[model samples]
Target: MEDIMRGRFSRSMITVAVAAAAVSAVLSVSITRTLGQAPAARPARVGGKPNFSGIWQANNEANWDLQAHAALPAAVTQPGIYPYDYARVPAAPVLALGAAGAVPGSLGVVQGDGQIPYKPEALLIKKQNAEHWIDRDPELKCYLPGIPRAMYMPYPFQITQGTDKIHIAYEFSNTARTIHLDKVAGPPDDTWMGHSVGRWDGDTLVVDVLICATHNLLKLFRFGWSPQRA
Candidate 1:
């Protein structure tokens, strides 16, 4: 019985020693692991200002047709590619060509029933404009697509922001907008891009735009920014 007790104690001591050795090895490995520098630093405010520096873009069909719409025929169509060979052609050439550039149906992003509010006369003008959009659209004329329109255009834009100024460079028409943070004054001129003044409300940037060329063009826009890095 004495020999048996001694054997049991020895075995317990051996098991405890093995467990201790395993724990020590694990801790040693954890300590020796190489933790390289993080790939990117978290976004931080400089001089107590929001950092809006980034490439941003809108993903929607707003650029094509602003209102909610069903699939529509393409703007332009040409004769069949196989002009002489009528037998090989499946159907009308316009139908085949139109299928490629047809605008996909969208529920639309516009607020309130996805329709713009216009007076009777203005609505009539808009309908006429829509009929002649190919020729009358401001975008086709290489005009600076104005606000709200510029924000959601189907192109990416880069924003470089500072405490005193914010610069937005758009991919379309190489257009851009400058938002002054300090100066308060009347618009120096009436232009497509317009004049902007900006202020911060928490992390949200509020910009007041004035386009003197058009009536009642004072628009206030807000852009909220978060510091979480992706």
Candidate 2:
């Protein structure tokens, strides 16, 4: 009887061990299959360069004023048509139109002392530009918005990149710019949109733009990490 009991106990222990091992093996195989089937990571490059293929935009009040500004009343206004309040006789067209045209307050993107370093004459010109912005602003006249302005115009822009060329198309005014990766001469004529030559500095896309006699340098890092895109 004792011998039979010992044999039965040993058999039970072996059965439990075998069952546990089988369960563990099944679990290990399941985990391996799940991990293997996971989506692959995004590629590092597209067409031998950093991929900048996406719709990009800037979300800030820089379009209104490059410098920090309080939410003050509009600079220009006409006599209010409403006769209810004499104190509010001079009201901006934006106010008359209601909240749709209200300007949101924002801090400046300019680094350092929060002031643009301009010569006296240049400062005077800037003031005049602001004072008569309705008429003097190039954007109001449908002029081509150049380099930095185009990049941050509170509108969407798309980048289509190839091995030897990159095309940037903007939503505002249907503005577009092409960047040649191959060696090429500057633009034949100085235009508002300018000419761009692009190269890769490590991971950043460095573009040197020449407009008229002025040279504007731009560096784009983290090509597709915008909140809207992400």
**Backbone clash total, candidate 1:** 0
| Per-candidate total of colliding backbone pairs | 0, 0
TM-score of each: 0.59, 0.61
Any runs in candidate 2 off by more than 4 Å, and if so which? 1-42, 75-102, 213-230
lDDT (CA) per prediction: 0.63, 0.64
**Over the stretch 90-177, how does candidate 2's per-residue lDDT look in tens digits?**
2443455454333456788788977876657556655655545455445555666666677887889998888789999999889899
Worst 10 residues of 1 by lDDT: 221-230
lDDT of 1 by residue, 23-128 (tens): 9999888766645435455367745876878889988877655677665555332335655432222234334554654556677887987776655755665555
Best TM-score among the predictions, by candidate number = 2
